[model samples]
Target: MLIGDVARRSGVSTRMLRHYDALGLVRPTGRTVGGYREYSAEDVRRIFHVESLRSLGLSLKQIARALEDPAFTPSELVSDLIRWTEDRLEREQELLGRLRTVDASAPTGWQDVLRIVELLQGLASTSAARRQQAVLAQAEGVPVPAELLAGAVLSESDPNVAGALRWALARAGGDGVAALTAGLRSEELDVRRRAVGALARMPEAPGAAAALADALGDPDPTVRRHAALALGGRGVTAAVPTLVAMVVEGSHDVDAAEVLGTLSQDPDTEDRITTALADELAAPTADSATRIRLTQALVELPGTTAQEVLRRLAHDEDRAVALVASAFLGLIREQPPEDGHDERP
Candidate 1:
């Protein structure tokens, strides 16, 4: 077969075949009557082999080594090809994601497109400062796609940057909730914590409260604690037990106690919160320190029930518990004469 016939038969262009010949990749073995290059059957087979290797992302030089070098073991070369292909695939996937984010933004013009790209790049930057700046910029009207913020907030490790990202996500509202919900289901505990944290910031977003409520049962105590605090702030009485548990565990227990106080303002839930605290106080699991924390948490409750609980605990068997409760009750007694009446009177 002549070069033209081989090219036509193999789908390799004649110009490419000539280039392959120049590169000594697949030289035709004979000459036609016109002195043009001619290909024997074996040469045609080698041409097919080169094209086959090329299809696997082999460079021309690498293909030459693969085809001609007896010392070139395919194991290492194939491994390298796999790595290269994976790298290319990862790049393509990243590009596709960026394009999707841009498309989702529905950019009005090139300026909007550029701003979104720049902000997206910043969110992915190695520097926490840059990521934080990107979030703040988006908050100030950078038109960043909400999904991009959702994705960033999940993986952000820097406390400051993650806070900024969560703030931006809250401002972005309902659009980012799906991404955050996906984060809540992540296998990594840190990721789940971050997801719940961001979702907690957007309590008013559709399903945000529900997502946090679900997170209340997360195996990670930190995740559950955050969910409980957020839910408590949102007046979800279901979080009372977890909030009381937070006070016992001393995990951001102060914040948890404050949120519990807020939840207790509702007459319906005040008894529930105080009851859970009293139960935890009486449980055998409550060590001296646990009892102390629970007693302090009671100080946050109102409507005289907490004061009555303190009066009862003030005479408890544990001296430290009695002292703490007595001290709190003392502070309550010292504040005299509200609305022209004193509790002592």
Candidate 2:
């Protein structure tokens, strides 16, 4: 076959076939009387081979080495190609994500697109200060898309930058709840913690609330505690068990107690919260320190049941716990009763 016929059949352009010949990658096996390049059957087969390697992302140089070098090993070269392809795929995925984020921002013009790109770059910057500035700049009327803030909130490690990102998400309202919710399911413990934290700061929306409710069962105690506090403050009685656990574990016990107290203000949940605390106190595993913390937590609650629990603790076997409980009872007695219900007997 002549070079034209070879090009036509192989789909390799004639110019490219000539370049391959110049590079000795694939040379014509013969020549016609007019001195035009002519390809034998074997030469055309080599041409097909070169095109096949090119399809595998092999550079012309690599293809040359692969086809001509007797000492060349394909294992290492194939492995390298795999790594290179993976890297290319990762970069393309990141670019695609950025483009999606920009499109989701619904930019009105080129300026909006530029600003969104700049902000995204800043968020991904290595400097925590730059990331923080990017987040704070949203307050200047840039109107950052909530999903962008949600993404930043999940990945941010620096405390200050993370706080700023959470704040941005909160101010953006509940739009980012779905993204943050996805973060809750991340295998990374830190990402799940950040997701719940950001969700805690979000407005009292059903999606945010539902996500928090789901987070209450997180394997990490920190995640569960944060979710419990946030949900407790929102009057979600579902957080009662975790909040009570926080009291027993002495993890953020004070905040947990305050939220429990607030939750107990609801007549329906008041007995449930008080009983949970009372049961922990009566648990055989309740050590002196745990008992004392539980006693202090009981003081945050209203109604006669908590007062009755405190009264029982006033005479406890542990001298320190007894004294602490006694002190709390004295304070409770000095205070007036709630809602005209007198406990002044």
Task: Provide the lowest-lDDT 10-residue window in model 1.
Answer: 137-146
Which lDDT values do the candidates have, in the order given? 0.87, 0.89
TM-score of 2: 0.95
Which residue runs of candidate 1 sit more than 4 Å off their true CA positions?
138-142, 266-268, 303-307, 327-345
Best by lDDT: 2
Whole-model alpha-carbon lDDT for candidate 2: 0.89
Q: Taking the tens digit of each residue's C-alpha lDDT, what string does model 2 give over 231-310?
A: 89988889999999988998999999999999888766888988888888889999999999999999998777888888
Alpha carbon lDDT at 81, candidate 2 = 96
* Per-model TM values vs. the true structure: 0.89, 0.95
